[model samples]
Target: MTGVLIPGPGKRVTLRDVALEAGVSIKTVSRVVNGEPAVNAATAVRVAGVVERLGYRPNELARSLKG
Candidate 1:
């Protein structure tokens, strides 16, 4: 299942993991994942690569609640 791809005990790759792997802050990873402008191209690429490799799936409902 998709859950197996996630690094967590369940099916979720937390922002912290992506940040650690990408060598960036959680905020930066958030910006890249949320498609926010201002992130550098290289940084975005790195974050995206990590996301793809880790099969990270952002929780849209959580983001909407925060927004």
Candidate 2:
């Protein structure tokens, strides 16, 4: 059963990683991910690009808490 070890479901790209990749802060990533009005359009685009590249998925439970 030996094979290449793949990152299983337990592995996830967090907001911190997105922020780091986008050269922004965690709060900025959170704001962009949540579609907050405060985020600049350009910044949002940048964050979104990083999110897509990194395959970052926000946690639904955390999203609900913001509502």
Candidate 3:
């Protein structure tokens, strides 16, 4: 369990969680996740690692709700 993140009982790891862990903005994480260009290469790599480590998944339902 070392170096692993455990979310709350019913909480899904979120973009904000990754951002917080990666020390980047939520938008930056979004760019990295969506393959958008222009993010700092090192920052993107860090964010990617946090995303994987935290098991972060964009909530499809939340995206649909935004539209």
Candidate 4:
């Protein structure tokens, strides 16, 4: 039997990618993903835009620990 070859890195979108796209830090991306308060409205919107564009989903296990 032959197996199929997957193209590119098979994995989920990471926080680092979101941060880079949003021009912010990983912590800012984390803040947006986790729905944390105190983040500036503008910054949150920018981060959210990046997250949506990249279809980035936070790692639940990691997010839980941060809270």
Q: After aligning candidate 3 to the native by TM-score, how far in Å is the CA of 16 from where it should be?
A: 0.9
Candidate 3, residues 1-67: lDDT per residue as tens digits? Answer: 1343658779999887787778888899999999999798989898898888888888899889998
Best by lDDT: 3
Model 1 residue 49 lDDT score = 91
What stretches of model 3 exceed 4 Å from their correct place?
1-5
lDDT of 1 by residue, 1-67 (tens): 1222346576578898788888889999999998999899999998899888887888889978996
- Residues 1-67, candidate 4, lDDT per residue (tens digit)? 1121222467777888777777888998888887999799999998898788777876789858987
Q: Rank the candidates by TM-score, best first.
A: 3, 1, 2, 4
> How many steric overlaps are in each model, in order?
0, 0, 0, 0
The per-residue C-alpha lDDT of model 4 at residue 10 equals 70
In model 2, what are the clashing residue pairs, if there are any?
A: none
Instruction: State, as a TM-score between 0 and 1, how close model 1 is to the true structure.
Output: 0.78
Each model's lDDT: 0.83, 0.80, 0.84, 0.76
Residues 1-67 of candidate 2 have per-residue lDDT tens digits of 1221333577988887777778888999989987898988999998898888778887889778987
Look at candidate 3 and give me any clashing residue pairs. none
